[model samples]
Structures are given as C-alpha cells and as structure tokens.
Target: MDVDVFVAAHRQEWDRLAQLLRRGRRLSGAETDELVSLYQRTATHLSQLQSWAPDPAVVNRLTTLVARARSVVVGTRRATWRDALHYFTAGFPAACYRTRAWWVPTALVFILATAGIGAWIAGSPEVQASIGAPDELREMTRPGGGYESYYSSSPAAAFSFQVWTNNMVVAGISLTLGVFLGIPVLWVLLQNAMNVGTGVGLMAAADRLDVFLGLILPHGLLELTAVFIAAGVGLRLGWTVIDPGRLTRGAALAREGRAALGMVIGLTLILLISGLIEGLVTPSSLPTWARIGIGVAVETAFLAYVLILGRRAVRAGETGDVTAGDREDELPVAA
Candidate 1:
C-alpha cells in the first residue's frame, strides 16, 4: 500500500480524531460514538502502514495519536487528593484491620522474646562478658553514657531525617522480602528483638534500666509497632505462597502483594512519626515520664486509628486493595 495514498484516505479521520482530543469538550453520545469509531479505524490504518515500511516520522506521529485516542476511549483514571484521602482513611486501615490476626500475635511474640532475652542477659554474667569488654559495656550502659548520648549526638532535624530514612529502609525490606515465605521477615524481627534485648539487659545490669527505658520507650513503642506490622504483613504475603485457600497461589500473591505495598506507604508515615519522637521528644529536656507519655499517646492513637478505622473499612468491604476500576482485570479460569 502506498503510504501517501493510505494517509490521504485516513488524514481526514485522523485530523478529526486529533481535533476531538485537543478540544477536550464533554463528548455528546454521538460524538463519543464517533470518537470510538475513529480510534478503531485509525488503529487499523496504522497497522497497515506499519506492515509495509512507512515513513518512520509518520509512524511515530500515528503511534502517539493512537495512544492518546486510546486513553480517551478507555478513560484514564487520574489520581486526585480524594484517592490519597481514601487510601489513608479506608485502604490502609482496612488492610491493617484485616491482617490484625497476623500482626497482633506478631506483636505479642516480639514483646515476649525481647523481654525474655533482656532478662536472660541481665541475669547472666557470662552473657555480659560475651557481649563486650566490661569497660565498653559500662561506657554505653551508664547513665549519660553512649545510651543517652546517641540520641543527642547529632542535631535534632538532621537526626530525625536520618532515622526516618533508616527505618523506612528496614520497613521496605521487611515488606518486600515476604515473597520468601516469611523466613526473612522472622529474621528481621529477631535481629531487632535481640538488639532491643541486649540494650535492656546491659542497662538493667548497670542499674540504669530506667534511663534506657526512658530513652527508648519514647520512640520505641510506635517505631517497633510499625516494624511489627511490616513484618506481619510480609509474613502474610509469604503465607499466601504456602496456602492460597480458594485463589490460586499466583492470584493470592498478587492480591496480598498489592496490599503489602499499600502497607509500606502507611508504615513509612508511621516510622516518620516515630523518628520525630526519637529525634525531638526523646532527646528533649522533658521529664522521662513526659517523654514516655508522649510516645504512649501517639502509639495509642495509631493503634486506635488502625483498629477502629480499619475495622469499619473492612466491614464496609474495603480490602486494602485498589478499587476494582483501578486494578488489572483478571481472565476467567475453568472451574
């Protein structure tokens, strides 16, 4: 087919389609019908031109035009503030609520493990010796030593940004690694637990457990909660691999994977808040109780947000998954 002859035949139709796209007016029913018809014909014309070697530049222009028209015909979903609003208010919370069975027990196990490790380390002199030299351990655990000094070591603003970046990285990894059947998630949790336990044990042995608690509790409660939620959601994602229930493993993985990604957004913000508390409140001159109270209050509000709002969202059928219109359409399978 002569490219020029083909172009001449369809130039009017292509121009009209381009005109309609540029106009961006509300298409009347008839106009909408015309637009669809024009898009289909133009698509076919481009295909014919491409089958024979058409002018490269013309092919490019047609390619762009076809893509734009396709968007108009298919209807693009532009994200608005309302979408973000819905994500936080409904999607994130519902996801958290639905996965509470996984995360709540996760939180319990982590706490128990942390406490047990702390107690064991505190009770055993041999454990303390294995941790570090006596002088180094004392220097860190002593009141006003490395334990307290670490928080105020850097400027508050810089420190907070650093903490936020670090925690977000950990949470991101925890959520993404869930495809491995949650073993890595468990390792992530265990590493954190051991670190927390070691700190508590060292401080308790030094008779400065109160000071350690004061520094950590201010941010640790919320910070650790965010971590646990990431771990639990990741675990759930990995579990989808093992037991997909009604859905095929791939389908279940896709569903839960999307939800885990959404959880990352929520956890990022949660970790940010905790980072602020660590940088600002924990290191501030506020009394220990006041600092701890702030942490507790913030943590309480977060939990309430997840439980109350999430429960309601779930009840309303929010799955923390993207809306039906937003997600990819699935092909039907033989039952």
Candidate 2:
C-alpha cells in the first residue's frame, strides 16, 4: 500500500511504454510485445492504486499512459481503399434507402409546389408582375436571355466549382440548422421552390418552356434530388428533438445527427455530379434529348442504388450510423 515504493518500482516500465508509444507505427516486434506487457502491468497497477493507495496524481498519470500504450499495442485501423469501396457501394446507398420515407415525400411535395406556382405564374399576368416587371420577365425568357445565359456566364470549370460550393453551403445549412426545429430547412427549400416556379412561369410565358425543360431537366433532376435529401434528413433531425420515441432526446439526436452527417458526406459527392452536369451538359451543344437522357440515366442509377442496394442494406440491419466499434458505447436503460 506504499504508493511511493510502488511508483518507484513501476516508473521504468511506464517510461518504456511511453517511449514505445512515441515510436508510433515504427515499433519493432520486440518493442510491440513489450508495450503490450507494459500496458497490462500498468493497468493492474492503476487498479491497485484505486483499490488501496488511491493517489490521484499517480493514478491519473498511469491511466493516461496505459491508454496510450493500449492504443499502440492494439493499433488503429487505417482506412483502406476497400473501406472506401464498401462505403460507397454499401454504406452510403444503405443510408439513402433507410431515409426513403423522408426524402421521397420531400421530393414529391417540392415538385407539386413548384409546379403549382409555375402554372399560376405562366397563366396570370398579375402573378408574373408580382415577381418582376414585364420587361424584366421578357428579358429573362428571351431565347438568348438571363435564364439561359446564367449557366454559361462563367467558364464551365469555374461555374461548376461555384455551383458545388454553393450547393454544399445550402446542404450544410440544412443539416446543421435542423436543430432549430427545421424551420430553416423549410425556408431554404421554399426559397428554392419559388425560384424554380419563377423560372418556369417566365419561360412558359415566352413560349420557351421547351428550352426551360431541356436546359433544366438535364441537371435539375439529380441536383434537386440531392437538395431534397438534405432537407429531408435535416427535418428528420429536427423531429427527433420533438419525438425521440424510446430514446432520451439527447440519444435520439445523436443517432439521427450522425446519420444526417453521413448523408452530408454522401450528398457532397452526389451534388458534385449534378454540378458537373449543370456546368457541362446543361450548356453543351448536344441535342436537348441527349442532355436530358444523360440526366435521366444518372438520376435513375441513383434511384436504383437507393432502392436495390439500400433495401438490402436495411434488411441486413444497417441504420446508416457509424459502425458499432466506432460509435460511443450506449448505456443500458430500462424499457
């Protein structure tokens, strides 16, 4: 029970463990074995101190040393190429599939709202005037006008980067601000919907609806879907605060927040694809049908990824959260 004597005896071993840890991925086999042995012995020493001597300073030092030594002995897993492969093929798609209920309806509602507003604007001069002056609307809808020129105004590469950055910010906002009851998420989507409606109304009024569809559809399908997914995940996070069901509010938020973050990473990649299409394909000389076809193909592939791979992932019990080993340990609570 003599803390000083015990410390004197184990100090050298503790120092050795620290030295091995400092070596960091460069340990020889013998040093690795020694580190494991030292970790176990140090852990026992910590236990004894807590049980008998309980010197706070010594105990804390040993605690930290043992933890570091343990990590060195066990080693952390590096992300391999295989890990990246599995994430995209399985993890990301599974996450999307699991959230289908949220995002699918989101897409539908947004589409309906946009369609109604667009139709109203196209049909009514008053509605159109409320948006802008007649001359402004005329310029926006002209064959070589604002709506069409906006995409090609910048060089394609710069435009793609700008679009990607902007979309990422919007998605980031939807995910991060969902903690505020999702009001921001709704507002963001509504703002976007209005923009779409205004464009549709303006173009249709000028008999350029064909040009609008051809230009927009080529990238809008995938681009808009990514936005809808971001909004849905954000709203879901907000709802978790209100009704966590069996979980404590904190636990539910953590779970859904992690899933929402995963969506953020996945959506970044998805939005990049859409950005490329918007910059390159949308402004290309290719026929409207070809551009639209490319968009349709990409959108369809994404849907299939979610429906087929995602369903399989869900069936296999994937919840789109971090893998069990990476997740913090959940304490048991009585049901």
Candidate 3:
C-alpha cells in the first residue's frame, strides 16, 4: 500500500471533517450527518494507513484531526452551577467520609502528640530554656504580650486574608506532595503540631493556659480538622502508590488524586470559615465559653455534613470522582 496513494484517497474526507469541526455549533442537520460519516471514514482510513502504509506524518495528522472531530461529534459537557452544588453537597463530603480511616487516626495522633509535647515543655524549665531565653519566653506568654498582640497587630480583614492564604498553601502542599509517598505530608503535620505545642507550653509555663485555650480553641478545632483531612488524603494517596489493591498503580493514583483535589477545594472553604473565626472571634472580647461554643457548633456541623451526607452520598455511589461521562474510556487489562 503506497502511503501517497492512501493519503490521496482519504484527504477529501479528512478535509471535510475539519471543515465541519470548524463550523461547530453552526453545522446544519445534513452537514452534521456528513460530519459523522466523514469522521468514521477517516478513522477507518487512519487504521488502514497504520496497518499498511505506516506514514508517521500522515498518522500524526490523522490522530489530531480524529481527536478534534471526536470532541465536536461527542460534545464536551461544560460545568454548570448545578455541578458546583452537587460537588459540595455530595462529592466533597463523600470523599472525606470515605477516608475516615486515615484522617481520624491522624487527628487523634496529632492531638496526643501536641498535648504530650506541651506538657513536657511546660513542666521542665530546661525544656523552656532550650526553646528560648527566659525573658523571650516571658514576653511571648505575658498578658497583652506577643501571643495576644500578634492577632490584633494587623487589621482584622488583612489578617484574615493572610491566614487564609497561608493555610491554603499549606493544604495545597500536603495534597500535591502526597505522590512522594507522604513523607513531606508527615513533615508538614509534624511541624504544625510542634508549633502549636510550643505555643501551648510557653503559655502554660506563664500560668496562662486558660488564656491560650480561649484564644486558640475558637478557631483551632475546625482549622486543625481541615489540615488533618488534607494530610490523611495525602498519606492515602502515597499508600495507593505502594499497594493499589485491585486497580493498577496508575489508575489508583488517578482516582485518589482526583478525590484529593476535590478535598482541597472543599477544605479551602472550611479554612475560610476557620480564618474568619480566628480573625473575628478569637481576638474578640466575647466570653471564652461563648467563643468556644461557636467553634464547637461549627465543628459539629462539619462532622455531621461528613458522617450524614457523606455516608448517604457514598452509599448512593458517589466516589467524589469526576462523572463517568467526563472520563476517557480505558482499555481493558487482564489481571
């Protein structure tokens, strides 16, 4: 089979398909039929050329044209407002619920580590000195000192935006770096836990543990939960690389990666709420109980969203993955 001869034979149909694709939504009913017919014929021609003629340039051109024609013929679904609604109401929560095994343990471990470290540092003068000089530590823990002043130093709105942006970057890093077998995610969580513990220890040594809790709890509960979720998903993704179970490594990563991305978007909103609480309520003059109560309520709502709605969505077959129609068809592989 002469490659030139094959190209001459199919060039007209390929050209016609390109024209139809260019016309796009303006295609007439008859032209639409013609476009489908030409697409099929060109696909057949491409197959024949690959088998018989094997011209690299011809194959490449046909591949691109076929892809373009297929897109036009099949019509891509554009995301709508409803899609966003579905994602939040079902997709995000379902993804979180599915990964409870990973994140729940993560939260518990982080809390315990933080508490233990804080206690050790608070009880030992040597440990406090290792962190900072007595004067510096005193300054940090003193009432109307570094810890309390830090929040009000910046204007509330500016402070909130800064907090939100920083948290977003941290969460983004956790989610994206999961492919590195979650080592980086562990480091990130550990660093965060250490910072919190240090702050608690310093405050406790100053006999200001109550002040510290009052300022931190109103925002820390939900904020830390979101971080745990991100870290847990990251670790889960890394584990998928090690043992993909029923699916191939690539497929497992793709599935978990997509879910991780969805969680990132959801966690962004969650962090925003926490940022607001930190910026507005943490530094406010409200009673400590009231402020902490508000935090508890918000945290409860989020958990209910995951356990109740997330479970329902999962049972109903939502995997927090992209819709089936949106994914490309995969070739079957035998185990």
Inter-residue clash pairs, candidate 3 = none
Candidate 1 residues 1-335, lDDT tens each? Answer: 67778778778999999888885488889988998898877777666565555688778877788888877777788889999999999999999889889889999999999999999999999999999999999889877889899999999999999999998987888899988999999998899899999999999999889999999998999998898889889999989999998876756888999999978888988999999999999999999999999999999999999999999999999999988776643434333
- Residue-level lDDT of model 2, residues 1-335, one tens digit each, is 78999999989988887877784358778877887888887877776776667798997898788767666555677878997777787788888887778889999999999999889989999888988887888888888799999989999999999999999998998988987899999999999999898889889888999999999998899999889888888888888889998876766898889888877778999999999999999999999999999999999999998889889988998888877656543434222
* Model 3 spans with C-alpha error above 4 angstroms: 1-70, 333-335
Off by over 4 Å in 1: 1-73
Overall lDDT per candidate, in order of appearance: 0.88, 0.86, 0.88
* Candidate numbers, best lDDT first, in rank order: 1, 3, 2
lDDT of 3 by residue, 1-335 (tens): 88887778778888878877874359789988998888877777766665556688998898788777778778888889999999999999999999999999999999999998899999999999999988898888998999999878888898988999999988898899988999999999999989999998889889999999988899999999999999999999999999999875766888899889878779999999999999999898899999999999999999999999999999999998888766533434222
Clashes of 3: 0
TM-score, cand. 3 vs. native = 0.83
Given candidate 3, what's the lDDT at residue 101?
98
Q: What are the clashing pairs of model 2?
A: none
Model 2 scores a C-alpha lDDT of 0.86
- Tell me which of candidates 2 and 3 scores higher on lDDT: 3
What's the lDDT for residue 261 in model 3? 88
